[model samples]
Target: MKLVLNTFFSFFLVSTLFGQQYRVLPIESYFKDISFFTDSSFTPIFPVSDNQVNYYNTTKEQKLRYATVGHYIYQREIIQVIKKEGAIWASPILDIQSGVERGDTAMSQYLNVRGLRIEGSMKNKVFFSGSFYENQAVLPYYAQQYVTNRGEFYPNSSDSSYHQVNAVIPGSARTKPFKTNGFDYAYATGMVQWQVLKSLSVSAGNNPIFVGSGYRSMLYSDNSLPTMNFRVNYTLGKKWNFQLIRLQGLNLLRVPYASNGEALYERKALSIGSIYFQATEHLRIGLIEGGTWTRGDSIQKQAVEGGFYIPIPGAATIQEGINGKSYAYLGLDLNWRVWKVLLYGQYGRNPYSKSSDVGQIGIRYWPFKSPNYLVHVEYNHTSSNAYKSSNPRINYSNFNLPIGHPMGAGVDEVIIRLRAEWNHLFVSSSTNYYLNQSDNYRQLLPVYEAASGTNQQVLYETFELGYNFNHGYGLEIFGSAKLRMVKNPLQNEQSYWFNLGIRTALNNHYFDF
Candidate 1:
């Protein structure tokens, strides 16, 4: 453990001398960059981590000759301690932002965030990265209610405080009280990767994964906290590629604390695999399979059950069908590019019930074959019990957040997004319509089968105008507006929000739902 700590700290400070390859790029800025996707030369299977290093190396940035400040601000990392012939490199990442949102009440909602990302590479065979973030925010009313209600838990027999605590923040680490009526939270994640062979690489980290070609995915999305996971990737020539992932997750509701009075959430394991085939230059198909199991039996705790390593697709589903030890699911992914338009769709089914299924379809079109402008439209639907199970422990979720869609289950949504860019200025807008159940669905909890759920409708819209200062860091100055109108038998809500701030946006924080 001491050696491990020392090695991690050393990498954080200064990268060793090795060629860094397969360094995963940040999602929001690089993966979602319209310019890169629209370029005909680039081929992507949405959020695959291995190909990023090659892409980064090919795209060179322009540098200033005489003005040191200009070079640092425009092209160079904020603090580049080592940059020797590209053999070894290390840099610090910073993202600080402050903004305000106006909603139902006279009081304004405020947000303040500070974060640091450390990335390094040791030669061509090894790479590592880490990030830390601190946040203090008075969120919108709906979001605040979600956090507070879910986190309101009482103390157990071995606990110190007798009262309840509301400290859980979705898509982030747990929180503590901040100032008056605000929440403060901090979290960290890191990764280390080693290339074992020319066509194979192994990595482990607490990282978020996105597995679709659209703004949302029915298979997996980065809407939840990053879980600790181990991954293996292999490439077989140009047409075949394979990947396997083992995820360690937490079920906070089962057992909140241990005898030592420390938070000891129930443990769960998930094994997932993907096989991708590039049948033609413009078409791609992928098969996704996974299974989840609880750490122990109903009577006592024990090691996780087996059946995690069967590589063939649909094997997990068959195994679950026979023994019923784990909950399994199967999905299919397809994408095709025709001229300037990209079309994609996904289908997923739960083995527990035939009615438990999900589907998504979307189209992305670039006018004039240019990346400067885009029009995106998508539709998604989930059955009432799509991700839920009779046993909460086996549900498809981690840390109380759904592993796939943020809308959870029993929801149908339509989305349209538009973006236009010129020079350094850009404007983007999004509109979403959702028809869902009144009670916010959570797959991690078992629901009452006899009770009838209310129908609700929500219309959410957002618009943003920003000036891009740097592409590599995703640094930008922006102002935004949001409108949300909800209608339901339980209650009705209408809110208008506005804010302005400068930020280095990287990860996707899903608050729109």
Candidate 2:
């Protein structure tokens, strides 16, 4: 303990003597993919969205066509919205994509996306950002099953034999019934950031975030909607960094439509803290701690967490009473760089409180001689009920989405991703296999029971080919094949999906799950 503390102080003192400044790129992929980043690990060690994105790399403008009109237009970033240098400035963010696809079944496969964003900074001190997104689609059968099972957008009353309604999306109202079994969803996100000191910064926003650089997250994830929150970051140059986040979340359990007054989605307080160290030029380590607590009922309006108000480790367990209602999560990960290759792994457990464990191991290799080619392989597993809870309102979920792992609990998966880039074009492919175990414990119950069934096996694969016609903008063709096999009852199914489109700008690509 003493040695660790001394190391931290030594690093801090050295960093203070020559404090360097760095900002986290926007959580969006475009900013990340086009910015100055550390290979596949991405910008600033993957924390939260509180860091300001002060840099935008325009060097990759080779694929652009007529993007610059000899000095009047530069990548269309400032179509003259406000292009003054060193003064207040702003620009429009636009993305439009429409495509036609088909599956084996009769369901229509029409995919369309429309998005708009407005972002800018003033005097390099204050900054603002906002985005609006609208999407409509005819999803494949397996993806459709995942959405309908959320139990949100419908009342859940086990009072009768037939009291369940299949729903497509949470926080979503049916969109006038599309051609076939299609659905629609809309989202709005915004944030403001202020740089107070070279070593300190703060931001308040309602935007989704993925906390880890890996393909999946075991801590914080963007699968859920933007939770209104505040974030603060402290850093001592590019060597050491720290972050704290507090979010306002919602519970998805629903009440009957016949009730006199509907219950507001139950409120939840999610607090997270993390510290990362660039231990050496080739090695880095990160420590994360978090808590999820419910509000209302007998509990007061204040935070009743076991861990410190600041960042500290704790077991995110659910006890029978107060101990049972609250949850805490803690974990650590390491990244090792050997020349051009990167190796990483993580281990997390909620033992005493929640009888579950989680782990991940992965390697990313990008040949130093040829940095444009890459290969990544990873394995992830979550014990039964790892993200589940005895309290419906306090489980590791927001609305209908799991905040930790996308598969929730009781699943083992292997992921392999390969990518190659050549000037204006890129090709990539990924495959995933998940072995899932059905939960043995009943919902909202404090006890457990023995499982009476077998596990299910699922396989998912995807391929993509994209070409950039304009600086940072392009056309993409993508497809996926999913297969699920079950036992006991005996079942097997296969489905395929595809999409092709031209986009001036694009948002996060979340279908990777």
Candidate 3:
């Protein structure tokens, strides 16, 4: 371990020979609007929400959402009960209020939501932040099925016995019961970071993250579940940045899970190390290695080692051969900017395994050089077993949610998006089409189900128009429509929603797949 750490830091030493300052932000995708901003920033891998919190808290001023519309956001933050106690501070406030009515349901066919955010810094060295939400919804037919089974935990147990429910498609996801008419769940994320050195930082938390500049990532993606994870970032001047990430995830099962009377969650560890470069003003490239290891019957933890083989991105395979079973994947990213437009592409695969891989290519156009006004399109495809393992316990998932693409595997997606903004007024739309292999989610056995060649398909589209109100704490008034068409149905499934709400953050969770 000492040798590994030393070697890793040596790269930073060589990189910083010219000396460069490092910056970190707590929010996973905090530094945004790249199309309109000049500085180049590294994008953290998805679902690891607390990256660089210490760096950001110490070096950069918190970006206030009050874009000065009506100035109400500042007042709401008056809920801040503490300020400046020897470098300690706080901002605790309730966020959004929203209600949505969809499809042919009557007065109660709606969704209701409330949220909270708590943030602060301490001792000038540590920073922490958390967000919470309580939501209840009368989802469309497919959505209800997706969430319930997507998280299907059969028969909650008060202990020995279980409270079971009927299931469709063999089983369902883990779904918590809600009000008489809908389903409800609580989502929470909290993370803390500490600055250990001028050039290095550590962050640990549970949340979702998005990697890459495209609509999706070939390696890790936001269309997954929040994970309990830790991340380390080191900068070597202006030319190189390195990141090491580790995750402890579970492969959920349909039973009232118990391991020797303990809540039995499968154990899987992921180690990803990446090096990024700014070759020139317009060219950037990244090389990354990722390893997935499953803790079979024994849940003992594993060590993180040897994942940074640059010329060979499959270093994880070395340990996998010694161990019982594991998966290793590698990625290459090319990001090039031409004046105002950015073109990017990525490819990732596990050479140690078969029938599991992903490839993506996409571009973003900033017409008029405005971040708020933009067009994006991307194509992505995943082989059937991309994130899966022979051991169902090691499949890349938590709460039955994938840690990569929302569609799981054996899927291809074409996504297009358009957004136009004028200060407080905004209009955005996205359409995604999917060609899915039938066994995408169900083939969890030691071997993946063979592809049938023939596939199922789905197309989903959404349009929204909203205006920021006072830019206050992300408060806005919006109306939106969504439609999904499945291959068999032939007819489209439509839903509509409108609300007055505050969204202090983007929707990082991938529930729309």
Candidate 4:
């Protein structure tokens, strides 16, 4: 830790270029709706951090000329604790929700979350942000099942017998039972970026990487837990931008026990490279490539091998191919804006197999180009072998969750979402339909097999209405209802759940699957 800090400080002293403080908007639809509606020409690649948005107005302080206590209390970051050449801002994160289910098993559910976020810049050249959250919740039935099944287990310390062990929360790590049917877990993410030159920037962080502009991304999505990563972003001109990221991922399924009965997760390294080109005013295109490989003892001793650090797209994949353990992916992202609506699509595949692939198409329609309303429709399909690896340790996943899509693989899905905002009031609805057939989808080394029990269809719908009291950190009160139906040869089930709560909605909590 001390070495990293010293290195960062050394870079900070030498950075001579003038750059804006870098901060990314939350990677959730609720936080990005207004911005997308206002700026239709924005890139389809998600989590637009380098651009300006309404919610995160860094240039202007959110203070009225005649500011009072209420302005400081409800309208802005709780504290601008330090204001040198730059400012240090902090806010409390809170989400308290309660709900009840009326389905096969009628019961009550609740969520309690508390945390803090701090972000700022040093001399407007080096930027940093961090947040830590602690959460406890009793989830709905379907979501609970997803969590329970994806958890990792280890041998018992006393008897050396493996049984039901830790259940992982989605986008989080291991969890402990909170109550009768609840989970308690926590996660933290931080980022530091340095603008090295006029058109170059470097950053390192622990956060989910999102690479497409839809409800779900075929290339990569922030559906899994964040991992340690280093990224370099460069721009040649107005028409071309490039990014390279190197990250370390974990495969919980192959954990080796230490002498003290501690589980040591297997680690892998991934290198991702992408190029975006603004071909014309109406069309934009992006090409992405990546490769992942297990970090054996020879390579794990070092942070990254010299050859693996090549930034050119496909270099790592080509190098790994010679070693015959290549887990490479290639994808294309495209978006065209015409007649006031944006059309987007993605095509992704494992380069080694013809059948391991994913495809998606979607549209973001803003009726009459209104900033208050949005309608999104999307279709997605994944082949049975997509994201699977013969060597399970190098699958396209981290901590047992798929990094590409929330649903593991071998599925067809259609999703429709609608959103409207009127002053401080908002309402939204989402519907999803899924056809799943692969029994081995969730396994690391998945292979398609005909299993009658695996064939099931699901339909899910959710609606929510909320009133925003503050835009800073998105403090709002909301009421929502969800309906889920499952049909298969063995069983048919229907479920309904309703919730009411106030929360500082900042991150995405995906339970729709």
Candidate 5:
């Protein structure tokens, strides 16, 4: 088998050197009997104007055409069908990770197991890519029950899981194990694009949408919307573009919050459709086109109080609230390049009842033509009055509900990173500082609380490095450490992690026995 594989690879390389590269177009042609006009056998049949030949004579029916005015070749009605086949391309990657993390004081000393991940992409038009991951580290939880020094027990729970923990704690002597499923990730995505016109094309499939320059997006965050989304994109003229998308099933991988009392895995909802538009390569705007009715109840309505809130507070409140209703959003991004430096900024707003706004700006400096050597600095600001939680304490009770803290306020963060790369080797380091202030002032730490009664300010940081090799191999290392001094039960928390990865490719182009 090894010998046969080597022989196949040798022949594959030789064919790639001489075969005509595939070019997608409206029509294509290839003829062996066509006569070249430059040859003496071909003569101009029409009057020569300005010493220019008008037509060419050829024996093959596939090769009769008129010459254009300015030394151009023109084929009026010939259809080209070039038969070039047996092209193959593939990329595969495997990542292995091992890291240890200790959360505050109460969490158990856990062992970091090696996590494995494989991802790759193949193409000739049809492409496939996916990733899978698992880990044996500390998984985040929302509630827990513990015995105090007084021999009594305290049940810590979020608003959503309070009932479940309260009932279990009174009878159990041992601390109920907080359900943390170590580390988990998922695999998704397949897409296809077809060229329909010279300047227009269409693509449809399940894919991830990461728009704008901000690491976090208010309209759609990487942590929020990693699911199956069907989208269609259109290009108009040279400066305008449009997109329409319908997200049927949402895969909430990171954030586990759900108003419905169901297992995280069982909870599924239809996202309100959305439409996006871009003009002049500088600005983009998108809106949640409308709501979609599915089997599950509307979590948006449950997040609010009393099923719904009256706008006037009296005089017969609106009977039917905006349940399972649609929402709207708009976003804008701008990029400017001056010399070797580039600057970009993005701003977006989610116009739901509990709407939020986010903005970001960043600058990149590239002084050389290398793989990944650049200095980047960015700042992000997010403010929401609806979901702001003032509590600083970490809640490990229910993984499916948002702990009542402060909702609908603003948070600010600044990140500065420096990256250097040489060939397949790359190293990057960065730090982030978070300033969080919300409405529940008295519930926060004393160090940041002002006399005016506002939640205290806090900060978090992280750093990462990675490397990739030719022939589809790569590795990455990352670490995240947080320093917080909040009066809330959530103590100052910190953790560290590292990962190594490898990748390769396999291809069987039009295999024939």
Candidate 6:
């Protein structure tokens, strides 16, 4: 652990001493800039007059030459136009990372891309977005690690050896334990927007539905169904806005199922929609219903959901919602002049159709006002049944479902985190406590798990520090340590990692451009 910590800090110090460039800019400045009319009283630049023409030449040609018009001249500049044109796009990033578990060595190298575009005019518009990721890694078995099950319980025993598991399908020569370098998957979606009236517009696309303000929701992630959708949005009064949407499922990815039989599962397709009303400058109310078609095949159903946000004293904010799929939740976010806080709590029945009720709550606080210097502290708690059988199974029996199997259940955790950022430097520390009760240890070990299991109460801690240079160069160093106080006493795990990243421009690199 000491060696790992020393190595992590050394990397960050070296990088900070000789790293590339890094700069901070406002979020709004990141988007395109457009100035349609210079002045309300001004006319077009064409058709010049004698005196006006001379002035135009003196102001535009002889002087700055910023722009030219008749006597009524206008000076307007468009910035960051390329970003809005959707002509600039980025592919996924590649990172090399490594870790140690119980003195066992684990390593991974992966590429991931997340891209989005929004382009449209009063006449027409189109949006495209998606995620593609490929990961290759060396992993350990479940029994060797603590895991959580569908019922939210931690397990104690390891499954049979990988070589001993069923290797072939029954009555057939098909390979059973399909093995490969790692996991690979991709998802893409697009949407079009059209103006139906001066104050109304309609859009259709394949997108996830986010109806509420919580971090996780039955409708938040694309777990159950991926659907094509259509929506109509309009403006009523000066402060009122409305929207309605309908969705249809489309299965494109292949998922595995336990039934063994090749089941091309088909969803009856569900319809879902939402309406948002901006009652005031700081308040919004949204009503949602039906479940959009996701890219999976666990269930073909829909339900109602609603969300609300309001700002009160001390900049306090509250949001709550109940959606179909036996899920319900509520959350709060507040900002007091010197202290920023976020408090959230949620409750649901079989969030993923598992046979257990799940509940979670978290709180975060930030101190300091300057954007360059800040401190944050957070705590989170989660409790559930942790049973495996009640968990949803991956519908891999069909080729149209998304990748990976259904997530197993049985997770109970408490996490505390602290972070600080100053200038180009950032540091964060976190500690996690786990309680396992099932046999799904493998599912809980890897950052990504495929099965269910139980993980007994254990303590895990991590620390990270990084620096960004002004020349688009970035470097980060981090380390983690995990200890199991119970059981056969697996070796206390400790590892260190270093990352070098760069953001290069394909064309012009200026943010002002």
Each model's TM-score?
0.86, 0.77, 0.75, 0.86, 0.53, 0.47
Q: 201-317, model 3: which lDDT tens digit per residue?
A: 788887555566676777766444566778787778877877877766555533344446645644566666778887886677888776666655332545433442222345566
Q: Give per-residue lDDT, candidate 5, residue 98.
A: 40
Count clashes in each candidate, considering only residues at least 3 apart in sequence or on different chains: 5, 4, 15, 0, 29, 65
Error of 5 at 279 (Å): 6.8
Kindly report which residue stretches of model 4 are placed more than 4 angstroms away from their true locations once superposed: 1-22, 40-46, 50-70, 81-84, 155-164, 253-261, 297-307, 368-370, 437-441, 445-453
Better of 1 and 3 by lDDT: 1
RMSD per candidate (Å) reads 6.7, 10.0, 10.2, 7.3, 17.7, 16.7
Task: Sum up the clashes in candidate 4.
Answer: 0
Candidate order (TM-score): 4, 1, 2, 3, 5, 6
Candidate whose lDDT is highest: 4
Clashing pairs in 4: none
Query: How accurate locally is residue 250 in candidate 5, as Cα lDDT from 0 to 100?
Result: 24
lDDT of model 5, residue 405 = 17
Model 5 error, position 294 (Å)? 7.7
Each prediction's Cα lDDT score? 0.67, 0.55, 0.56, 0.72, 0.32, 0.30
Compose the digit string of candidate 5's lDDT tens values, residues 389-507: 12111110111221111112355667676667554355666565556544242221101223243454444344445543331112233333323333323444454434333322111
Residues 238-318 of candidate 1 have per-residue lDDT tens digits of 778788888887765434445785646567787778888888876888888766776762225767665666766665576
Model 1 residue 453 lDDT? 54
Q: Candidate 2's residue-wise lDDT over 1-513, tens digit each?
A: 777657655643443332212223445544433331244332233322222322333333323232124222334344323322212223333333343333345444555656666666554566677767677766656556656555344333564212323443422322334556776667777787777886777888886665665666777666566778887878877777788777786654343343356544446677777788878766778887656776643223445454325443343333223356566667787778687666777766654445567778877777544434667788888887576555555666676566776666776889897877776577777788676644221222111224353467766677768764444233333333333333324555555555565554435544444
Q: Write the per-residue lDDT of candidate 4 for residues 374-437, one digit (tens) a residue.
A: 8999999888778776666567777777788787677799999998877669898999988773
The TM-score, computed over Cα atoms with residue i paired to residue i, of candidate 5 is: 0.53
